[model samples]
Target: MKRIGIMVVAAFIGGAAAIGGYKLLEPKGGDALSFQEQQNVLFASNPKVASTGAVDFVEAAASVSPAVVHIKTSYTGNSSNQRGGSPFDMFEDFFGGGGRGMQRAPRAASGSGVILTPDGYIVTNNHVVDKADKIEVILSDRRKVSAKVIGKDPNTDLALIKVEATNLPVVKMGNSDNVQIGEWVLAVGFPLDLQTTVTAGIISAKARSIGILGRSQQQPTEEEYEEYQRTGKMPTNNSIESYIQTDAAINPGNSGGALVNANGELIGINAAIASQTGTNVGYGFAIPVNLAKKILDDFRKYGAVKRGYIGVTFAALDADEAEKLKIDDITGLYVTDVVPGSGAEAAGLRKGDIIKKVGGATIYDSPDLQEKIGRMSPGDKVQLTYLRDGQLKNTNVTLKGENSVASTLKPAVAKNTNKATIDKLGASFAPASAQLKTRYRVQNGVVVTGIEQGKLFDSWEIPKGVLITSINGKPVNSSKDVEDALPATRNGMTRISGVGPEGAFTFNIN
Candidate 1:
């Protein structure tokens, strides 16, 4: 009986040990400490857990999603014959010429837009509804309405459209100038026909020029010009682009959509994307809201954009070019040529001068300068800081209107009586008669009696009967003034103003 009691006591001890092992090994809360207590104990022992936080886009998405809208455009496709030849002919050439041309259906495209006013004024990219025969806007609430284009500025790629609706959801405008690099941004648009998509990214860069505006002042090659003629989509020669670069996923349908900050304020208008597969490959660009605001204001006041021009051809300074120019830093544009009589020239900005700043804003490159000046109107006075001969200079320039020749200067008579022909200018000039000056109501000027073929004047389409009033903003009374006024450099650009057969004309010569 004592041996049996010892075995039973041993078995009882074994069962207790097994129960304790299971309690210790099993998950917390199974007769053991709670999970929270276990975590506290582990944390107390180690004291090193990651503390990363997540960015919640819910609030931003909620605020902006209602303001973003889907845009649908419809246009009649150009007939095959209108494209230079019928597609049936090409197919018949491969087979036999018995097939007739087939009629193409109307072309339809989709994009996105942002409401800018509570009264249903919308802003979008110009390319979105460039030639749309009909434009339809689908609001987030699924209300369909027809919209009409108010105004479009091709240079800035912005368009204003209006719908006959009231109390529309409008996006809050943010100061794009305050947007910082690496700041969180949200792109709200209808992408891939999906219900209002919101994409998150950071501002990768600012004041970026992607050459959507043609980079060179020279004439494009035959191929380039032909392609532009065929596609009708080449960047304008004087188009201004100061893009905000981001890594956001902006696809085709996202064009004209709102790019907002974390606070859900509109900062940019999604305009373009860099892609090889005809879709977003990460890189995207937006038009700065500040620039857009200027255009919008102009559109509201004027029937079209009243763009300001500085009248200077400039090149972006690089490290090597800076060293060559003896500049300490490559932070400003190097003025290659100041158009004669332009605001730049009037402000004493000489060729080879470095434009350091405009209106207190630092000029980093050509696009920066372009954006600053393009946003201003004619007759606006701007402060300019430039570097010339290693000395910094400041000047105030009164900008001129687009047609300054007819409005600004009085005609002057030639001092020299000799009638001379300028081979470089490709025109022969004679002093204007007093009767001719009286008829033209000019104080003094010269008349072009002859023009040579294959000359600048010929290329400008200036006929022999035109009067030469000024070259490069300088009043020219004689052929000598014309010859001396022409810059010695071949590649230099000049603006020649005179009265042609039609009216006062200004020609930009390179």
Candidate 2:
């Protein structure tokens, strides 16, 4: 009996020492495990119940709803003071309508967000907190905390925010590339000012671009409006809209919510709704998690998205477009023009090339290419498969920064030298005739004799027979004078002062 007791005591001591050693060497709870792994371990016993049917969303909804947060924002003035073009007419649903003009009393608005990290990293739509003065987030446990915007990308309509808290529930990020049509998904959010709501639907489509960012994006000041009025074009819109379409009943206040799979994995971020009445009409859109992952990571690393550009203006081709362009193929994007020093130009892409594939994925429309390129940054190499004169060819192009491309296109022309800079203007010029100068009452300038499509001058819509007085605030009697007067940049803007058919006008090209 004594020997047995001593053996039992020795065994207990060894067991205690083993446990203490593990406690010292094991990964610390917060730093060792990622948010997903932590959650997995926490719910190991109550594992995600796989859906047996397409409509079984009970497990998914329960898991996702806890991570979908309610975000309330306060704006100092009216929210609807600025407006432009929108391919999707769902802005009224995402942001409540208000009158334009003067500043109004402070107002409150609400939206949804998905917690991405236990330390309070959240993802939401940029429009939700675009101009908000203060933001408050309500968690599943009904606890309220203030959040600060970490970064915002108006181009993609996505924003990252964080709160001063820990142990927050997080939704696991899933592979959006594997999301299939007709697969059941859940839209979880706080919609129509209600509590956490979950609606089930199937994936309706993929790679949908609706052009909604222009409507809710920030507008330029009055001086900047001169370029828009002169050019008759919306200011350079770099908005990327490769959304995953769904039938999920996302309504007002659903912006920035979670669109999760039946397994409760986040596949997309609930963004827009297509409804004529500002309510659900069986059409909704979500930013694919595949794209959001890159964007959110960019937001975390840099304060803004480090977007890369292919530097080619293109139009998606259909049977009608192919027939119009006299092409045999009915699919692919028709490359209209390549930027002077862009990756497309460096890769030998010309005016009539057809872009069929990016990397290895086939390109059916703008979104397919835009979203893929949107995921990359400057200096990234992308393989392109295209057709030159009906012969398929491939090339690897190294993307360049926006500033590098802009600088490559010299914005001015000097005398008799190659005419390269003049060509860059996309317009032919002639010395202003004396009679023409007398009629227009301008001193010395050049006439816009001809304009080319898809060129800077054409984009400005400068008509033929227009007389110019000066460029960059210097008198220009010839192309050489215009060139000498132009500076590389004035605060990174090219200023053009000229008299057109409309009247004497001055505008800045940004």
Candidate 3:
């Protein structure tokens, strides 16, 4: 019985070894032994195995760690699902190989932020702090500080946050507009709680749109409402039509981070990625600095983007449309209409005019031209280049900045129609020509830019644009004359004197 048992054990052991051997030698759809084959995975999985390249990734990671930062944010409501999307959280598990609505509770989210200004103006994706209740910015140096929201533009999905500090290292703004496909670039941010993590790639394309922010959306909805709730102010959305496309392996926490050139200049603000499986598939987009500059200026001056308006809309021009329009070439923005009496109309610009440039910059399409014009304020004159009958004409047009260019911000002061006093007069005026000035250009008056659209100014014996030479017979040349001419109309209707678009004309008011 002992001999029989020993024989059975030896046979079992032999079968076990044979099965293991078969697994080791199993063919992975190939007849030859190859390093990359599945049969060789056991060896490949071992740490002692070498990489495909001569370089070491460990050294690169160590070098990038110091520059990365972790960002942690706490917000109201249930936010458990997003708890891991932050840069800090990202970098925390980044070495281990790691939004909503899908277990996806609204979890507190943490991610990375990049220190752009040494004095502590960190830039990160607007989504990271969109509705944060408490935002805590931690530096790669392990210092934590409370960050205040400075300005955020959602159309581009970038936000600028300020922390108290000085002598800080500010990343030089790079020209994302200048980046082209396949050009070397770098990505710096906190991913998975890891700090100063650096990744490298190349410019994959230009003006790439991934639709992550949605069309015509400037500020994220949640962020805008928060701004309103905190300060009783509303933010303006600046449409982002220009973006720098890169292949820098941008992941979730990479939003609002920096896309720098080899010179370490910030060319673009990393914005979005394209993935069928919810991760980077080698496609990403960033807002160009040119557009970001305007957003920043709007934030500084008006609390929101004071977008310039032309008051006319049109469809994008395709090659077929260009041919139908008899365009000489395809390198110009076709003007479909001139906003009646707006800046474009006042400059003799017509519906058929092809806008070739704004200021000194050549514009081949509406997106580029609109973005440039949108950045200007009213009263800021810009030169326009257009083609009229194969003849290029350059004309200068003054913009309107207030209602059109003033801040889009809601007035904090109550709308008090009740001023100290009420002064009503039946008079109107507008800018006078040099000849009219010769008669008298010293009146503090502005041309009746508006006549209540078909009221006293319309029925006036004078015509529209008829330089309101005077108001109530008061010597009127500029806007001041009309104001001075305003008579206390407590009694009956009043008559005013003015010049018509052709010659001297009269108008009446009450």
Candidate 4:
């Protein structure tokens, strides 16, 4: 009887030990794991290993395709008036559209998205879901669900959306700052209205700005222009276009898809393709995931992008730009003007100062500065290195919210009068003739008689012969009129309204 009791006790103790071991060693529930940990766990369980010797993308493609979803969007009313579709869809007429002003039909568009969270958070392009009436998400397991836009930012061409589902596969977000040129990567999406497809390519470039986002937004109007002149407030487009350029075969339906590294980590959200034929033509652009993370978090928290501004107007300085601006320095950004009540003003950043660096990264071009600032929010502090009078100085600038008021940033205008103004314009002006006025449909104006190659007008691409109807809200029929209207406002911004080949337009020069 004593031997029997001892055996039973020993068995019970062994059973308890085994149960404890299982509880401690087993993987945690999906909800309890971080994205990186979850992704690591997933790949660990898979038997196939990605080959590193000869550029095999089998493992990455398989891991990413499941998280990349097919997104179909429906637009009500006229398709011409709506804004949902590929950015290249504007070129549809050049490709397949019968002609302009043809009978329009309601449009149904399809794109792609990457699942960022298991509970249905997804990241896509703003153009993919902007003004979409209904969004339907199709999962890899052949399950269909509805999705709604949480927030959409046209500046960065990014949108955060959510679906009403759980246990969805997610793509791990990777550090795009570490993505090197010529590195092999994969593009995963549903392209050409086909099933999930994967393509491989190399990173062609980084910090590329194609100016697509600016073209996609509504053009400035005369009223907005007039308001800017009257109030000394510049009309802000704030379009951020820093993209990771790749040679991946991204097509029309691939917008908002995943551009993943060899580790199957999400690095970019594929946005645009540089093709006039409305198809892939070797160049494809993706919004870097580094810039998208802040935007996505803002969407989840604030339901809008809380974009911060440095409160300065700057031009990326190259050899040609420096020559146009009549500056000696060929690198860094030349500060043209500073906005009043801006953080830049408080930080004592003046016009003529060249911004050399942001944080510690060198500012080689607009994208370098734009992308870094684009990732930060209002009230965030940033360190800037600038060159002033041949002296390099540093300052900490606390970014201001769009509506926050602070210091007064004086405009960068020459103390000298009209001669400096005309020189700054870099274009000779003449009184508009009756024929020119009639052609441009303007009441009174001056013509861009001639443009100096290395001047502001030429650099801005303001073509010769375009009618300049007004300057700083004053009707300019002659050069004398323009000279008198120069620097009219205390804020020191010059607003120009005119008719160009593209029709009525307005712009501000600081």
TM-scores of all models? Answer: 0.63, 0.70, 0.56, 0.72
What lDDT does candidate 4 reach at residue 27?
53
**Model 4 C-alpha lDDT per residue in residues 327-410, reported as the tens digit of each score:** 899999999767666899899999999999999899989999999999899999999999999999999999987656311310
Total clashing pairs for each candidate? 5, 0, 66, 0
- CA lDDT, every model vs. true structure: 0.69, 0.74, 0.54, 0.75
lDDT of 1 at 344: 68
Looking at model 2, residue 248 earns an lDDT score of: 86
Model 4 weakest 10-residue run by lDDT: 407-416
Model 3 segments more than 4 A misplaced: 1-68, 78-105, 192-194, 209-238, 323-331, 405-510
Model 3 worst lDDT run, 10 consecutive residues: 413-422
- Measured on C-alpha atoms, candidate 2 has an lDDT of 0.74
1 against 3, candidate with superior lDDT: 1
Model 4 ranges off by over 4 Å:
1-54, 83-105, 221-235, 405-510
Clashing pairs in 1: 340-472, 411-444, 412-444, 413-444, 414-477
The best candidate by lDDT is 4
